[model samples]
Target: MAGQAGRSAGFNKEDLSSYEYKKILCKKDEIKTLEDKTSHVSDYELCEETVNDFYTKFRTNHDTLKLKCDNENGSKCCRDVNYYLDHATGIFKSSILNDSDKNKLIKIVEEIWEPNLRAKDIYICERQTDLDSTRKRSILQHLHDLKEDEDYILSYTKDYNNHLKEKWEKIISYTDSKPSSLFVKIENNSMGIVENYKNFLDSSDYICGNNLNDLSAHDIKISTDMDDFLTTISLDKISLNVEKNLCFNKRYVDMLKYKASNLQRINNALSIGVAVLGVLLIFIFLYEFSPLGRFLRRRTKKQIEVDENANDEIPDSYENSENGIPYISYHSTSH
Candidate 1:
């Protein structure tokens, strides 16, 4: 018995070892899956961080460029221009500028660089070696070219400034003229006789047809006088009080038109409803008197009679008959 028990104990030890080995293998697979998931998450986070950094740099550079360009008297603009020119080949490779912004930047760079290039050429010519006669001649030629380029730059700058000034003046004039334009619109809208009548109806305390007709004659006279005034008056002649009155008149006129339109729609809806109701009554009357309707009614009555007869013939009970056998009554026809 002792030897047999020893053999069983050895078998139990082998089984437990195999089970632990399988459990360890499962745990290793789980750890590997977790590591893969963590690696993917890290990669995504790194990509997002890179995108944010790119946008931040792009915005910073864009703002810096704007500030540098806006400061005409500062050396920073020159430095920025030089930097961008040096990097011009790789500038559009980034997402820093879209098509329109890139075009504007190119134009600005051209304006800055062309004048600067003239000055640079002049400086280079002045610093050239005087030992070589050929170099001296080349320097003289560069100086002449520099003088011509400077003259061209000056003329172009003047034309650009004048163009900007004209644009600014036009913008200022347009800004100043907006109120007058609005006033003109209001005046034209309010000075109409039909609009005046509508406005009077909308503004009146009572909104009935009688009140509408009663106010018409006075409004017509006022509208005619207002129209004459508007035709004779210039936009500049309109005072604050006149503008306010015109605006009020326009507001009231719009409200009146809205209300009148709504009323017209309501009237149309009511007329349609009445017509529909009349047609429905006519249909009901025709249905009651029509031969087809009478035939349907007769059919329905016959169906009800058949149902009643069927119900009457159904046996109320299956009681025993006189011979003591259960009797079921099924109505039958005899020929």
Candidate 2:
């Protein structure tokens, strides 16, 4: 039977890429189901099977991959006993419109399946190889299906693919590729993958069957310490910014205070200057109006006349007969 329909039938580049991605994911899941079945038979069944057996067993009904008909806890009426990849891919690729659908589908698959495959036994060599092939195929298909060139996304994917290829080469050179590599790169690039994975986990709101809850208190402590370190750095930045603002405020306030003080000083000086000028004007008025000033003026006039007579003739000393008072006599030459 074919798979169920997706939420939207609207065709877009994203939708097309999603469709292609779903097909690729269907292919990967099919391989995983085969890998799981073979693992039960023998460890060697991973690689010993012929190409004909590879196709045959992979195409068979995988009971291990089947969903329960009555999964009351999780199925939520999606009890078709079909894998999500098969269900989503069938609906998307029934008709090929664009690559966006294919990209979206592949992203969905990676978002869903990678975590599951990672939590499984990490030592499976054939399983790891299959996952690598699947990852490469997804990356290549995405590159092919992009409607417009997104340089940044393309560059990031290329870098990520190159990293995966390098890891695969390293693993293949030493021992056959281990199943752990399925998520090793992802875990190493946790910054990139964790947020997307969290979104996926939240979207389905389901814990993956393979997600392990094996972290001890010590691991949690380490994680907490790392979180504290980041928090401390952020706090330090905030504190520095606050301190800078405070210092700027203080400087601005000081400047205002200084200006106020200067203005006060100027006002005080103006008041003192005005007072001094008033006192000087009062002194001048008193000097002009006083009796002493008039007497000084009269004395000055007599001195001036005496000096004029002295310039004309010599002055002789004379005494009054009755009082015997010494006096200066001035002779004037007739001109």
User: Which prediction has the highest lDDT against the true structure?
Assistant: 1
What's the distance in Å from true for residue 228, model 2?
46
lDDT of 1 by residue, 137-176 (tens): 2222222222323333243443323322321232222222
Global CA lDDT computed for model 2: 0.33
lDDT of 2 by residue, 196-238 (tens): 2111211211112221122111111111122232221211122
Cα deviation of 147 in candidate 2 (Å)? 47
* lDDT at 113, model 1: 33
Q: How does each model score on lDDT?
A: 0.34, 0.33
Estimate the lDDT of model 1.
0.34
TM-score of each: 0.23, 0.19
Give the deviation of candidate 1 from the true structure as CA RMSD.
Answer: 38.0
